[model samples]
Target: MAQPNAQDDFAKLSADLSTLRSDVAKLTETLAAIAKSEGGAAADAITGRLRYGAARAEAAASGLAEEGYAALQDAKARAQALGGDLGATIERNPYGSVLAALGVGFLFGLLSRGR
Candidate 1:
């Protein structure tokens, strides 16, 4: 379950990244068109501003991607650790684990009644 959720999260992240890349490409093309269609100092100034804005946006996107990658790594590590711990606990007390599972299921059933 954890693996499936992680995969889904990665899939969503990949889709979002692709969308961001496409948007950046479109913005770059638009800026280029504007710079080409106009002339003189005003056009130069606009191009400079657009370039600066694009650079900042690219940097921000890069930072966000790095952060997301780090978070995903952390989540994967935590999930692995949790799975190990749960396995150890169940191995140490199979009957306890079974009882706990049953209790949890019973509680869920009670809470979910008529839903």
Candidate 2:
């Protein structure tokens, strides 16, 4: 058999290099596609977690609001009952209440004068 020429060998080497470059380009495209898919999946998972956390937070805030409203209502009821009791007591002893008020004012005036 005749031996291959130098030009033939050079041409074969160039062809192999071109084939290698094409294969590398295809591999790069495939890897990029896979990474994009995985990134989307990861983002979806994070979004789900965030939504769950937000829902829990909202529920907790709603519970706290209910508790606060109950406490305020209880405080208002107590204050109203105390006011009625105070009014009855004042009506029953208007003269005594006036005397007590005058005494308190006199004491406060004396204290303000540093005497």
Kindly list the per-residue Cα lDDT of model 2 for residues 69-108, writing each as its tens digit: 9999999999999999988989999999899999999998
lDDT of each: 0.95, 0.97
Model 2 regions lying over 4 Å from their true place: 1-4, 103-115
> Which ranges in model 1 have alpha carbons more than 4 Å from their true place?
1-39
CA lDDT of 36 in candidate 2?
97
Cα lDDT of model 1 by residue, 5-95, tens digit:
8888899999999999999999999998887776566778899999999999999999999999999999999999999999999999999
Against the true structure, what is each candidate's TM-score?
Answer: 0.65, 0.81
